[model samples]
Target: MQHLSILPILLPLFSGALLLLPPFSKTLKRQRLLAVLSMLLQVVIGFALVASVQFDGVTQYILGDWRPPYGIVLVADPMSSVMVCVTNFLAFGALCYATGYHDRTGGYFYPLFMFQVMGINGAFLTGDVFNLFVFFEVLLIASYALLIHGGGKHKTQATTHYVILNLAGSSVFLFGLGILYGTLGTLNIADMAQKVGDLEGSVAILAKIGALLLMVVFGMKAALLPLHFWLPKTYSSASAPVAAIFAVMTKVGIYSILRIHGVVFGDDAGELANVAQSWLWPLALLTVVIGTIGALASPTLKLLTANLVVLSAGTLMVCAALGNEAATSAALYYMVHSTLVAGGMFLLADMIARQRGKAEDRFVVAKTMDNPIFLGILFAIAAIAVIGMPPFSGFLGKVMILQAAHSTAEQLWVWPILLLSSLGALIALSRAGTTLFWRHSSSKQASDEKQTIHLGEWLGIVLLLGASPLLALFGGPISELTIDAAVFLHDPSLSVDALLTSPLADGGF
Candidate 1:
């Protein structure tokens, strides 16, 4: 169990490193097989970790006999466990999709993909804030390589902008961490939370400033308003499988916000408690408004899905800004709902582009696909789920969020923006669906040049789209898990205490 906690990060790191070595590195098929088997093993480990955390309460593993507030530790609770599970699940599905669709592979694609997952897993599992920064860079660097994988003009352009912007965000992140460590003399997340609670006056003010700066860094990563310009072009230009995996990347920032604010700056956080609310709430609403508008205005299917990605982030951030257990819980549920739906939508867009020839997902009157009905059904599922239609997880998630917001005075503002945002998403999706399926679709449509859909691509999209209804079906248990995760975050003493006091582990938890 102790090893399991570290394996999520180390497994991918070592696997990626070994794949780049001779013999294995020369064979793309061998590399792909290794990546798949490794990720599947990770999924199993992630599930067992989640189970262990639930049974044993919070479990901490001190690295190399070092303890918390002094040495490195990896703590697993409901939140990190579920997050790791979701990330590995996405990586597996996307890898399957990549293997089937990509005409060329090899290169650093397989290795970088593994490192990307490792970075995401590390960010989720680490108990130290500084390690979070390390993981963020790991993921971002791999993403930079992945972004330009195919080597095109547009991709190169997107990669340059993305690299520059994230470099700036990284600098801000380090500066904020420096301020925090200088103020509290520690980088361990658990210790920072406790020390943050002990501050007063000038020290509290410094800590708040540091927290706010860190929030700004996370905001850029999450694609929040004013910082979201990089997402549309970057996501739209990336390869389908890459874009699909990137779906969870934004949610990474959301998870950080929930974990940091809910634990480090909770109600007992003195003056810093809710300090971000005054600015965070309005920014979230504006992001929703802008993202909706961008979706409505997009002329291409990939671009539209890209905009919806931002919309999902902003919508979830509304709950984060609310800063309550119920709200955070609902936000987590919505996060899961949105990630799958958006990933499906991105892959679907790629398929449409592949089949549509010159029109290439332009939302204009293009040729109908070979399996129009099959493709159309997939698109409908995505649109319906994303737009929050009934009997699906999206609707349930949205309703839960609205109800949670009702408990706050900001409900007046939260309700309208969310409702209007939903309406905006609906209108945009309806127009796109009509343009793609209704007006352009033809009975006489046929294409000798149409590319046949592969089994692997179908399975990938199906797994993602299929999850929405299943989430709706299992809504009770999933929601309960989110609520439990939120409760642990709200009183993080349960998460932090074990880190400080747990005995050294030889092998297992």
Candidate 2:
């Protein structure tokens, strides 16, 4: 039971390493089997982690017999455990979809995929800020390779820009980390939370600047305004499965802001309390506005879907900026909903592109699809889910966020902007669906190239998109869980005490 806390990171680590060994390395068939099995186990372990945290309050797994504020630690709280579950479940879908044909694009796909999952899980689980930077690089390096797996000029070009921007961001992250360590004398998140309030004058100013720099890095990762130009092109250029998993990548930044800003600079931090909200609020609104406009003007389905990711990130940021338990809860529910649906949209867009010749996912008239009715159904459900329509989880998530905002002074700005952004997403997706499904040319039909949709593809799409309605179906318990997670996050003392005060007497297992 205690070891379950680390399995999410360890399973992927071991699986990825095993894939590099002789028998598995030589055979793609073997690789696929192992990767799929590994992902399934990861999903199970993810669920177990969530359940463990639910039953045991905050579960801390200290490494190397050392206690926190000194030793490396993996803390599985309600929020992080749920994020681990979402990442594994999403990875399972993306990996399944890749095995369909995309994995065949390169020999190392399975190993790289496993490493990518490992990095994301590590990012979610690590309690130390330095390790967060390390995990960020781990995922970024794997993603750089994955982005170019299929090998296209556009992909290469996009990957190049992606690599450069992130490298710069990584450098800035180090600068911020250095400043924080120098000023606060510690890098553990819980320790820093304890130390931040007591700083005054020069040291406090340095700490504040360091925090803001880190926020800039996080904002770039979340695809907030002015730093978001890389997202649409980068996402649209990748293979479908890679793009699908990348949907959760943005939420990693959202999670960071929620964790760092909420716990470290929270209202209890005295002088540093709510330091980020002033900056986060206006930028979040601009992000939604600009992102919605991008979606409206997108010329392709993948691009439009990518912009919607930006829109979702902005909306989540708004909730984070509000900085309350209710707002945090709303952000959690919406984060899961948006990540799943957006991933499905990317997969759906790829399917549509495959069926449409010459006009591949672009908003141009081509012959009707092989299964217009079926694709139309999926597209409609996706649009309704992403656009916040009734009976789906998107609407419910947005409503919760809106309801949470009512208590904040920013409700006046938050309500109209959020609702209008939903309207904008609705309009954009409706136009895209109509263009892809209804507007077909009669002149020259598509060649008799029969595209066989694989069962794995269907499984992947259904697993992700289907979660939307199911989330709405089981909204009560899920929302309560999120609220509890929010409450846990708002109180940093619990984490500090769990790690530092009451550690196990025996050495870490």
Best by TM-score: 2
**How do the residues 1-509 of candidate 1 rate in per-residue lDDT, one tens digit apiece?**
65678889989999999889977788877887888889889878888887887776666667776656777777787889888987887787787788784626326788899999999999998888898999999999999999998888999999999999999999999999998999999998777777787888998888888999999998998999999999999999999989999999999898888777667777877777766778788899999999999999999999999999999999988888888788989988998899888888988999988877777888898777667799899898898899888888999999988998755567888888888888988998889888887666454444447587777788889988888999999999888888888888887556555456544222223
TM-score of each: 0.96, 0.98
For model 1, the stretches where C-alpha displacement exceeds 4 angstroms are: 103-106, 441-448, 502-509
| Inter-residue clash pairs, candidate 2 | none
Q: Let me know the TM-score candidate 2 reaches against the reference structure.
A: 0.98
Best by lDDT: 2
